[model samples]
Target: MSTSRGAPGSVLAVDAGNSKTDVAVIGADGRVLGTGRGGGFQPPLVGVQVAVDTLADAVTTALEQAGADCVDHVSACLANADLPVEEEELAQAVQARGWGRSTEVRNDTFAILRAGVDEPRGVAVVCGAGINCVGMLPDGRTARFPAIGKISGDWGGGSGLAEEALWFAARAEDGRGAPTQLARTLPAHFGLASMYALIEALHLGRIPAVRQHEVAPLVFTVSAAGDPVARSLVHRLADEVVAMASVALGRLGLLTEEAPVLLGGGVLAARHPELDDRIAVLLAQRAPKAVVRVVAAPPVLGAALLGLDHVAAPAQAHRTLRAHYA
Candidate 1:
């Protein structure tokens, strides 16, 4: 695939996640002319064409609002585009839509990373439903993890934490593990009397499996209340976050230099004191020059900024776009 010619200096920026999508139209000078939101993009589940069709809905709305048919480039930071091959496949799919002259596809983690920094020179660790890490430099070099869950040697996402909590709670209830408050709290969260009942409800679909993510926050609550087991789990998550950040920093050759380590996603952005403090302390020990910050900006801004970068927009354009999001 090659770049298609369209309106010069215009961009169609898309940030497509597992649960939702955000699209924006940016003018040459970095003003956001229009924006739109749509349902999730899950190619692995719905197939490539179907997922792109879902994205097209939002793109159509944004283009209508902007009163334009197409733009010079499309910058899409998408979930499930974990590997370079997947990104290429997705890029081709997006380009086929004719929304832009050119398209670049990246893992959604890059949006979080780019959104948190002034320039593309940082690492980002995102821990929402799942955990992933990525790092990038202005020079176009990048470091990343496969981040495909347990089979990929990844752990400590919200769902993973909930499952870990349930495992320990179940064992504790059955005298197979150390006693912990999780045994009581885990079942209580679901209005059950025991881990046995909770287990049965989960197994029998009485409680939808999607609701299990709710347990992750309770684990933090239990830890805050000083349950040793819960605290251990929280601290372990901190370890994993720091470990990934340090490794990414090293891979980018930024470990010895002062670099931003952006924290985004539900778990990390929650500002859980225990997890935050532990991650800070551990990261400081491992990568003393690492500067950490939570990314509060919506990631569509990052996609737009990446588009501007691709087109070589002026510095004022970056500032203008950032101010709009701010």
Candidate 2:
């Protein structure tokens, strides 16, 4: 449960998320040699072949920048890699790269857990562009969200905020939902006047799903401005995320007062300091002995930590990786 260094050799760590993919290479002395980034490589949206190709391009680019021809090992933590088949496909693709001659692949949440908490036992809730949680107990039980894309009940992340905003806009226009400032706020944020204009832009293919994510920031703005509807929406968001974390804690029997809970992801990390405070307070209310903390490091750094942790990397390698990643 310590943040000590691991063994010698270069490690290549990759974190592929819904928004972007990052690659980092570190030397034996813990110095980061090179890092590279590209678009999301999820096979669900982008084809599996395309995803693999993009990943290789990213990894190779990092290696070149690091002044290395090859790595000794690789650890890839990818979003949407929930299914076993998906994990295998990615593992094969990465191993094919001759990276460190060995490769291991896992869910990005696990990497986030590694990057944040030093202990092997604990739970991490990630509420980034997507909402997901991954946990590992000392007893070897592990759990993660089913990650059923947007079709399933995945409403604790950035996508959820966008969806909620759009729903509100639609409802306000239709007289079915409450009259909220979202109607005016969303249009102004996107430089449109009415929700109708916003829909027009979306239908014309002028707006991409990625652009939908922009609504998230607007949600924060509206909430801060004390719009009743926005405040309720954000509260719902905070509750959903807390529920996700609680599920993990409950399963591990860590729901007691002394358990450790770590909150992470872009959406939660930004625009939710109060929510973080609220989450900690709520955890205490539910289980007075729990230790809750908001993780500060980006998940990519967590993925890099996984690489070193697995290899028993030496102190030099840890320092090099930290420096390079930093």
Candidate 3:
């Protein structure tokens, strides 16, 4: 389990999410020679070929930036590899490209786990383009959710917040819901005077529908201003995060033991005091021995660390990777 004797190989670490893809080329010496980013790579929405092509652009750019042709391993944590079958398929496809001597394709959330903890054994919840969670124990037992979007009874993320914000704003404007600052703030975010105007623009295609996800931040801003409805949304998100973490802890019998609870992704990383405080309080209540942390490093760092784990690189190499990534 210890890789103190330095291995000899490079790591091509990829952190591919729904909105952006980051690729890093790291030497065995733990130097991050270069990093590059590209557009989202969602196979379900855009097909497998398009996703691979987009990934190719980012990987090519990173390798070019590093002045290298390939690496020893490709540690790819991708959003599109939602299901086990998908992960296998993508792993085969990536290996066929000969980008590295070996490859590991996993759910993107795993990067959050590897990035935030030194032991690589803990629970991680990611609330980026969507919310997903995974947990691992020292014994290699794991707990994970489908994270297949709403079909899996999932909620809480930028997308979830945006949809709820729009719903509340439209309802408040129509007199069906309690009045709140969201009606004014949500529209104001897009330079519109009212929620109705924003709705009309969205319906008429004047505003890109995808931009609706951007409204999530306004919910936090309004909540901070003491909007009851906005606060409720934030609380619900915190509740969901704790709920998942608690279940994962129970699954691994780590509930009564000291464990790390790592948080990553944009929503949690935003450092909203209200949401952050609630998560901390709830975790302490639900799993008293849990250690909580919000990862500031990009998930690509986690992917790189996992690659180093695969190659059995020395601990010094991990320190070097962290320092370079720092």
> Which candidate number has the best lDDT?
1
Which residue window of length 10 is worst by lDDT in model 2?
1-10
Question: Which pairs of residues clash in candidate 3, taking residues 3 or more apart in a chain or in different chains?
Answer: none
Q: How does each model score on lDDT? A: 0.93, 0.75, 0.88
**Per-residue lDDT of 71-109 in model 2, one digit per residue for the tens?**
766888988788768889889877876766678888888
Q: List the residue pairs that clash in candidate 1.
A: 4-101
- Comparing 1 with 3 on lDDT, the higher-scoring candidate is 1
lDDT of 1 at 101: 86
Ranking by TM-score: 1, 3, 2
Candidate number with the higher TM-score (1 or 3): 1
Measured with C-alpha atoms, the lDDT of residue 322 in candidate 2 is 55
> Ranking by lDDT, best first?
1, 3, 2
What's the true lDDT of residue 87 in model 1?
98
Which residue segments of model 1 deviate by more than 4 Å?
Answer: 1-5
lDDT of 3 at 321: 95
Model 3 ranges with Cα > 4 A deviation: 1-8, 64-68
